[model samples]
Each structure stands twice: as C-alpha cells, then as structure tokens.
Target chain A: MSPSSPSFAVEFDEINQEIVLRGTMRVRSPEEMTDATDLIRRSFGHGGHLVYVNIKRLTHLNMTAFRCIADVLTEACLADPQRRIVIVASSVIAWSAPLFETLASAQPNLSVEIYDSAFYPGQTFVEDESFIPILRTQTKMTWRHEREILPRHGMKEGMAIADICCGIGDFATLIKRQFNPTRLIALDHSKKSLEYARRVAAEFGLNSIEYTYGDASQMLLADNQFDFVTCRHSLQIFDRPDILLRELYRICKPGGRVYITNEKNSHCLGEPHSESIRWTYDEVAKLFSHFDMDVEMGPKSRRLLTDAGFDTIKVESFMVTNLDGDPRDFADVIEAWENVYAGQMAVRRGDSPDFIRRFRQGFKDHVLAALHPKGYAGWPIWAASGRKPF
Target chain B: MIERQVSPEPGAFEQMASLTLDTALFRSEFHLCDRVSEYLADIVAQSHEDPARYANFSSQLINEMIEFSFRSAVPTGQIDFRLLKNEERVRVSIEFAPVSDHQPDWLANDTSAIANGHPAVGDLWGLADAIRVNLHTEEHKENHVTLMADFALLEAVR
Candidate 1:
C-alpha cells in the first residue's frame, strides 16, 4: 500500500532541464509509479525528458525495488535519447550499484553513470527507475482461445487434469472454466504463490481444483492418477529437465496424455530454432521413452516423438496477437519480452560491465523497433502432445 | 551495524547480546542453522584480507550451538552474535533459557573451552581463538555459551 503521505520530494530545474529526486523512495510500494508518473508529468513538461535525474540522496534502494524503478525509467527515458541519469549511492549499496548500471544501460536513449559516493564534477556517478505501472498492464493480457489448444487433448466434461509448476494457476483457472474438468490439481513449489492461487480460485468460486505445494523433481503424489498432465514454459530453467520429464510420465495413467512445452531457443528475435532448445529432443525422447510414456518437446518436435516410439502424436502452434491496439495489451507484450525475458537474462548471464552496457543498448534498440505505434506485437506457442501407449 | 533483538525481554534471561537472529518462527531444523552459519561467514569476512580462509569459523560455532540445543530438545533457541570492534573480535552466544529440569548431559560437564566432548568436537576448538560458557541456574535453568574469535584486517590476518 502507498504511504499515507509521500516519502519522496521532487525538485525540477526547468531552466536547466533537470529533475532532482530527494528523500526515500519505497520502490515497490503500491503507488510508487503513480507518484513517479505525477512527478514526471510535472517535471518533464512535455516528453518526460530530463537533462539529468539526480538520485544521489534517495536512500534505502534495493534490487527488488530497483526492478520496479528500472522498468519505469527505461520507458520514460526512451522519450529522448540525449537525456542522462546520474546516481550517487553510498558505500552500503556499492555491491549492487554496478548491476544497477547494467539495467540503466538497457535504455537506448538515456546515457547513465554511477558512483559509489557522490560525484564531484571531475568524478562520475549512474541511473535507475520504474516497474509497477508495467506490472499493472502485463497482468491484463488479451485472453487466449483455449480450444485452439485444449480439445486436441480430448479434454471432455469430467476428465482429470494437472498443471505442475502452475505460477498463480492462470492456466489452471482458464482450463477449469473452459473445459469443465471434474477434478484439477494445481501444484507449485512456492507456498506463497499457491496461497494466491487458492485465493484467486475462491474468488472465481472454483472448487474441486485442489492446490498443493510440491517440487518438480519429485511430486509427492500417487502415480498413474491423472488422465492428462502439463507443464509449460518451465523445463529449460530446471536444474534437471530430464528428471522432471520422467516424473511427469510416472504420474500419467497408461493411455493418458502428457505434454511439456518450452520456448524456442535464441528467444530474442532470431527464429527458426530446432525442436531441441538446449539439447537434442531425440536424446531426451530416447532416454525417457523407456518409462512407458511417449514424450515430445513441442508441436514442431514431431521427429523426436516418433523416434521415441509414439506411433500417433499430434503437434500444433498458436500465434498470440495483440487485441485492437489497446495500450494495455501492447504494454503487456512489451513487459513479457523486455522485463521478464531479456532483463532476467542480462542479470543472470553476468556479462562484463562494458559488454552489459553495449548489450543493454542493443537490446533496447531491438525491442523498441519491434514494438508498434499501437504496441502491436505477437509470439507463437509450440505445443506437442503424445499419448502413453495403451 | 544493526542491533537486532529476536524475542522475550532483554533482562528476561540476562542477555548482553548485541544482535539476536530469531530462527524460532522458521523451521530450518534440517538446514536452517547451516544457512545462518553460511550467511554469517560472508558478513564476518567483509573486513578481513583472508576472509575466505578465516571464514566458516562463525558457522562452526553456530553449528555446535544448534547441535547442543536440538540434542537437549530445547524449545525456541536464540542466537546473539556481537561485534567487539575495539578488540577486532566477534562473539556468538547461543542460549536456551529455562531448559526444564536439566540441560543436555554433554553440556552439563562441558568446559568453557568446549573441547573433546561432542561428536563435532573439533569445530569450535579448531576455529575459535577463545571460548566461554555461562550457565544461569538461579531462576531460569538457562544455558548460554559464547565463542570469541579474533579476525584480522587484511594486514592482521595475513
């Protein structure tokens, strides 16, 4: 929730085209971006552009809150390429500041410099900013036609289904509403996320969809109990994707269908990837095929499923497009690709500081080019399904 | 620089502790102590030159404390670690106040130096520069043990 009163102060230098933010900024607080947007509107006057943003005294900044701030700053700075942001952080924040430099570099327009202590004219300093507004827009994405994916699985009126590692149970809730499943189990490792899923399920007045805390490596549930099982956009990130696939097979009844879907490799705009994202699907298929369940990576990965011994298998790809130029829809697509995908990859990869600077610059240019006048953007989901032999 | 108090009153059981980390709420019975020790090692080493080499000593002290407490089945143990900046030293004290009719048998006869008693006998003796134990047997049957270790700045440790 927002503070009863602002914990921040903004001083705009209209003559010099500068905005100096003073005081504490609780980054993830409910009204963080709202306050920033107000400040930006008031300061930038026309295009949210500033010659400088002096965040030298904004104490109590953290990585979690930094993410919330960075998203906002990236978009705002995109307004003018020549703008600059300078952050003067205390020694306490030195360890995390250089990485913050990496994030600020994500903005193609803005030039950034950071200093562990306040910079004198001859010395140097860096930039940071905004994510809450983006979070609000992303959650309200355009709905998908589940029939484009579900009926192919023979989902009938009373069949059982499971979504493992179901983050917040978005897909599970959608399937429950569309397919009228008699029983559904939503499992994830995070108890906090599961609690949110339960609350969402209750809000929709959904019963019979049980929420359980479980690990992907070992689901502490009965084997061969589910008629259909699914895990989406999760395998590649697992420490052991192979073990997780086998676990999926262990819980599927004979003749029941199970599918795993992961994104195409080189996710940043170089398409025409192979069936295997990190490893050959044939190898994955061959290794786990012994478990008595047929496996496939995605719809495009037919050869691997056939090689794995599934005589009959189905494959399909669905393109998700924006809805009617809604700013929120465009923002949602931008959020997924920019913040969720590219941003995380940058942090995790641990690239050299200069390399990060160049990479973030290039990434921003690439994404801004892809985004449309109306925020029009689209991506495809490749899904392949195979039934365990009867 | 933080002075954290975990639970109960300060004078409740006579605690001269500076920072108290409360693991009472979380169940790290399987690995909590290990994680705390690991984290402490990182913080304790920040000012030292051979931080990595001199690391894990704090972990050793905490591990023994956890072992002794869990063995005695003491409920809700508290960890208080203090920084003696003037002396360039750190002290970690683990206490389980009013541990019922008796304390852990190994601890009752244990030395303030704490050597050759429990299975993890070598940890404290090998790591700590000094060790001491204080048992509050008057009102609360409390067992508080403290370990003081000298860590060098880049010059001193080297």
Candidate 2:
C-alpha cells in the first residue's frame, strides 16, 4: 500500500473490551492484513464475556479484507460459544451495517449492532425542528462577538474554511458574507438541519457554501484540507469531545488554527432575578451531565486543544447580553431553553413536579429580566483557538 | 486524449468525466485504484440525494472494478475510465487496449463467464445491473477491450 493512500489501524482497548478498526483497508490478499488478524486474536486473550468490534471509523474495506476479518471473528465465535462478539457499525456509513449483518447471519453467537445513540446522545433533542428558532437567535447573538473575535484567531478573507458540526448552517452563511472564504464547507450530521440550512442559503441567495452531512468524530473529508476550522457550541454537546477535536485537528492545515465556542450554562446571569436564574442555570449544567454532555465545557477549551497537540493557544470569553440586540430575541432563546430543558430533559430525567416548576420559574424570571427596562441578562460563552503545529 | 460520449437514448446516461492513465503505472501501485475511484465518486456523489452514502457506495464499487482491472488487464496500454449518470443509474466504463491477437478469446471468456454469474470475476460485480464486455476496435485505431458496468441509484440504504 502507498503511504498516501488510505490506511487502517486496529487498536484493542482492554479497559473497554472494544477493538476499534479505523481508516481504510483495501489489500490484494488476506496475508497483507496479518497485523489486524493478530490484533483480534490477541483481544480474545483478554478476559471478557462480550467483546465489541467497532468498525464505525473503518471507512473502506474491500472483500479481501472483509473476508479476513470475518474469518477471525467466526473462529473466535466458534472457539468460545460462552462469549459473544458484537460487531458495532455506524448508521452514517451506509455500507457497514448491511455488510456486517451478513457475517452475523452465519455466526449465531455474533451479532451486528448499529451505533447511533451511543455516539450522539443529544441527536434527537437537538435535531427537533422546534429548536430551529432558538438556534438562529443564538447564532445571531454570538456572530456579533465572533465576527470581531475571529480575526484575532487567524480568520482572514479568501482562506479555506470548514465549520464542523455546523447546525442549520446560519453561522457559516454569516462567515461567508463577512470573511468571503475562498472555499467554505459547512458539515453537520443532522440531515434535517442540513436541509433547512440549504433552503435558508438559497433564500438568502448564498450559493457558494457547500453544505455536507457527516459525522464529526469520523469525517470523510480529506486530511489537512482547511486553513481555518471552526466548531461553534458543539464540543459540549458531544459525549466524546476528544474524538471531535482530533478530527478538527486532522482537517486543519499545518499552522492553521481551529476555533471553537462552548457555553458555561452555570455562569448565565440575570440582574433582577439573579438568585432564581443562578439556581436554574446550575441545574441546567447537571441536566446536561445526566445525558453525558458537559454544558460547563467552555472554560476547558484551552486544555482540550493543548492535549490535542495544538499550539499558540488563544482563549477569550464573551457574554451575549440581552442589550446586545433586541431584548426579545434573547428572551425567545431563554424561553425555548425552558421548553427543552425543563419540559423535555428534566421530565425525561423523571424530575418531580415541584422540581420542574422551580426549573421552569428560573427561565421565566430570566425572560422577565430581559424585558425589564432596568434589568440585564447575560449568557457566557468561551471562544478559543489553537494552531496546528507545522 | 480520452473521448467521451453520452448514451443516445433519451434521459439515459449522460457522460460525466473521463480519465486516461498508463496501464503499467496504474497497475504498479495499489493506491491508484483508491485515488481514481474517490475522484470519480466525489463528482457523481454531488448530484445524489444523500451525498455521503452515495459517495461511499460509489467509491467501493469503483475501487473494486479498478482493482479487478489492475489484476486482469494487459500491462502495457492506456486505461480509459469514464463515469456516466442518469436519473436512475450510474455507469462506470473502463476500456483498455489488448494485444491484437488476444481480443477474441478475452471478449468471449469474460462475457460468457459474467453472463453465467461466475464468481471468478468477483461477486461484488453482481451488484451491477449489467456488465458488458465488448471489443471496440473501430473506436480507436487498435483493438480496445471495453468493460462497462451499470449500478442502480438505490433510493434507500443499500
């Protein structure tokens, strides 16, 4: 195999009892995949009743490579019927689930599981169309700060840009109009969001931005393809922020910067009802934590990027105040947050009626503070960037 | 230069692009199959309803076809690759020049084996709606062996 062509890695995580097969493997013969077969055999040595074979990131595998893997898995299944081998595939990669299902048919002890929810716990909650208005309003408020802040973090006109996890693509359209990137690709996993994004782009007569659907953790986009990569308010939503950061680093050109924005919900404040707003926003952080998300990840961006092998780090905090734009827009965002957080998430977590009422009151009070002539409401966001080393 | 021609049938396959490379160079490295396949897949995928899914399927199919040719085609010639698409189907056609005397036997053997559902040519090729092995001696100045395969544009996940 050529060095520049797609490659594969088989890594066994003993702690997780999972063997992750990543990248592409297309070889002339089974002998070329001895290392992968050896890894699977070694994984069997570990004492575990259930071993997960994760092929979610394995983008390409020809029949020869597939046959080699299938043979190893079949042997493992036959050797120990007491143990089960689960082949985990991703729904985003269309070929994997069906292809692995064929192997499951022959081996009774082995089965194929399509992994969607495990990767993205908040997919259903965020993809709801009702959240569209709040998302647009949130962007409208953040863009005001980001447009001035972006240039400090290496954003300039005519540079290639990619907006990873760009929900509804409103931010990308704003970037296009402001920065005039030579190439702009806005990628999101949610099909509904991307559809809405495309329609909005068309209505606004912005045709240059390429809207793509893809998983943020394992993107099909080629390596070192973008000069500036921005993922806004997305790192906190993912269960594996590290995996998402690794991808952002991969797509960024050497010496180019990757900028990210995240929120610290507990830091949200309102003057007139500071006590109520503070209590509710703290609960908001706990609520997201229950779903495996980190709403307080804003302050941790620097450490995350540094550990991901980025240098020249720059971090700043911005507060979206009710006074920044029309106060009603800020109120609308707070109201929508109440519906999703109190009505949906809190209820799903089986909170009691009294707890829900208290939670709902906080949002209503924040909205009241936003509309009050003498009151101020603010939502804190951290914007940080680190340059990929040359 | 590689020539491109759309199917004459109304609403049938419209030619997308054609690439020509030295057969020896293509066969020398295994990765060329992926590079070429990915390039074509990227082009065709843009028009699909689900670009990511279609790109993955198209790349797999195209890579398999190229790999098959890498193993079977004559070593010294130009490999002409063409991509064509219509509303319902996408076609990938590869043509390579065979040494004059080898054309008849190759054309007969490939066409018959493929028609009889032979596995020697690779089972994944069966996914194609039709596989035509033809000798286009008149199109070029020499005997060119053309291998064309058509795949349906699946509405749902395949």
- By DockQ, who's the top model here? 2
**Local distance difference test, per candidate?**
0.46, 0.81
lDDT of 1 by residue, B6-39 (tens): 2222232222235565535323453444444445
- After superposing candidate 2 on the true structure, give the runs of residues whose Cα lies further than 4 Å from its correct spot: A1-5, A11-19, A41-53, A74-88, A101-115, A352-354, B1-15, B49-53, B85-90, B97-120, B126-144, B151-158
Docking class of 1: incorrect
True-vs-predicted CA distance for residue B136, candidate 2, Å: 15
Measured by TM-score, the strongest candidate is: 2
Over A1-390, each residue of candidate 2 has an lDDT whose tens digit, in order, gives 111346789999999999999888888878999999998899987848899999988888876687689789998998999899999888777777777777787888899998765557788799888888889999999888999999999999999999999999999999999999998989988778989999999999998888877788878777788999999999999999998999899889899999999999999999898999999999999999999999999999999999999999999999999999899999999999999999999999999999999999999999999999999999999999999999
Model 1 chain A lowest lDDT segment of ten? A120-129
**Candidate 1's residue-wise lDDT over A1-390, tens digit each?**
001122456677777676666433433333555666567545654433345665544532322234445655665666555655554333222222443455555666555454332221101100111332342233233234345566775566677888876766767887788777877877765544566677778899986577765445445334576788877655544534565666666566678777656544323231122222212223223322332223333344455445444435777765444443464455355444444323543444444656445444433433343344433234445666667676
| Candidate 1 C-alpha error for residue A269, in Å | 4.0
